[model samples]
Target: MRQIRRLLLLISAVWAAAPLWAEGERAGDFDYYVLSLSWSPTWCALEGDARHSPQCDASEDFGWVLHGLWPQDEDGGYPSYCRTPKRDPSRAETAAMADIMGTDGAAWYQWKKHGRCSGLSAGTYLGAARLAYGAVKRPEVFRKLPREVTLPASVVEQAFLKANPKMTPDMITVTCKAGRIQEARICLTRKLELRDCGAGVDRDCTLEDALLEPIR
Candidate 1:
């Protein structure tokens, strides 16, 4: 009886230690999507400039760019890196997303990590990503800034709400990283309609004054 109990305990421990997005999780099993929009200038200021990324070039004029459309579980844990039968996107396919994603590599990575979990083919997933990106109206006020500035992170969220009247505070989250405004993540249904973010996706940055770099 002691040996049997020990074996049962071992099995329970293994189950508890397993990650949320295990390798074999079924695709298209998530409840909603989190559309991440990264602020290009902040990325450049944080890491892109050091690497001399092309998106950081003055001529690029990139402001808010699609980071990824992620599948999320309503509870808190989310799926990632799920197995999919779809073939990987080709160079041309990924490159086409560079205009809005900042780089082809970013597009490819997003497909590998998140898109695969959507249970859609690479082409279809990329197309859905584009549609989701276009659905959000990026605020033009930030684009017109002539120089860097510091402001409350909530102000960023408010800007998005004001620009998108359909979006409520629960549907959007502003995040800060390394003292800079990083990204604005908005929740959406599978059909690309605005929706409230899940519990795990509702974390908003609490920075009183976060630095925002002007578009380069």
Candidate 2:
């Protein structure tokens, strides 16, 4: 009994330290992403000019999400710079920013947005805790500066593209953005639809689409 108790305690500690997205298959009907993990103030910046508005004003703070599993490389995918415990070799700039902004005593969790309950099987992480950076107002200098940030959708698309670069743009990209943004008036964009499950399928017939749509 003492040994069993010790094992349970150890398991609890590890589970508490790990992100919820660390395990499980995120089907479109139900999926999850990490909103931010160890995000730092210096990490705040616009990733790129918005696709529609290159010069438009925006700022983004980036972090990691283990899409299908923990230590993503083990899933037979090329590892992302942020997924590994160590610094990313390719994105020196992002690595630096993440480090500077990484010291906050923030805990990470995968928010489950109940899919079937909401007419969408897909669930996403909604950050319930606030970090210093999350709630603080940025100074003017910080406000307008271009920061490197990547949306979960961008990461998802990139992974697919890396695997099949020759695949048509329409064939590979999954468009997802944060359900919640900073604006009080702006409601979250409802259920993101992922296109391109495979060949010859109707673009709108994806599981995400079906799940996201209200029951008729």
Candidate 3:
């Protein structure tokens, strides 16, 4: 009886803290967004021409593209599939997201997976995503980067801070894979300004020097 009671209390506590976990709430009622910017070259090297999309095209310079603007909680956990859209985005909608994100598949996936939980319409969510991405100021290192650059993930963090005065290291994280940086996650407030991502969102790279591969 004591164990059962404790478990019940724990469940109640989690339920009470809906905002922290992005659960038990309507869409758009949660915390800020994590504007995930993918290092396009990493994707190209990993997936190659097999995926065969505009984003993976060699002719286009997709250095760092908007992966998705995800709704994140105070904790690392985020909400998803809170609601389902009755229909898909129109052609115009897909086109609108092309430059900011990639293709219809990318836009629609973000819409269905993350945007739906945002409590905003597809248009509003995507528009906000684009706006949030546009607000970010890129670092010079990424623009004029060598074909293969290596530095600690924190080095990348410092570069961003130097470039954007309003930004702090706490507001962003670098995601790496196979000793290479896959993405740089920069968090923002609802107003699209730099904000600290809490402890839940952490730098998970175990590498000493994270490689930023070229956009070949």
Q: Tens-digit lDDT track for model 2 on 36-122?
A: 221122122222233322112234333321112111121223212122122112233323223223311111111122211122211
Q: What digit string (tens of lDDT, one per residue) describes model 3 on residues 161-181?
A: 787788877888878888888
lDDT computed for candidate 3: 0.77
lDDT of each prediction vs. the true structure?
0.92, 0.26, 0.77
TM-score of 1: 0.88
TM-score sort, best first? 1, 3, 2
lDDT ranking from best candidate downward: 1, 3, 2
Candidate 1 vs candidate 3: the lDDT winner is: 1
Regions of model 3 farther than 4 Å from truth: 1-25, 84-87, 204-206
Count of steric clashes across candidates, in order: 0, 11, 1
All candidates: TM-score: 0.88, 0.18, 0.81
Score residue 74 of candidate 3 by CA lDDT.
Answer: 83
Determine which window of 10 residues in candidate 3 has minimal summed lDDT.
18-27
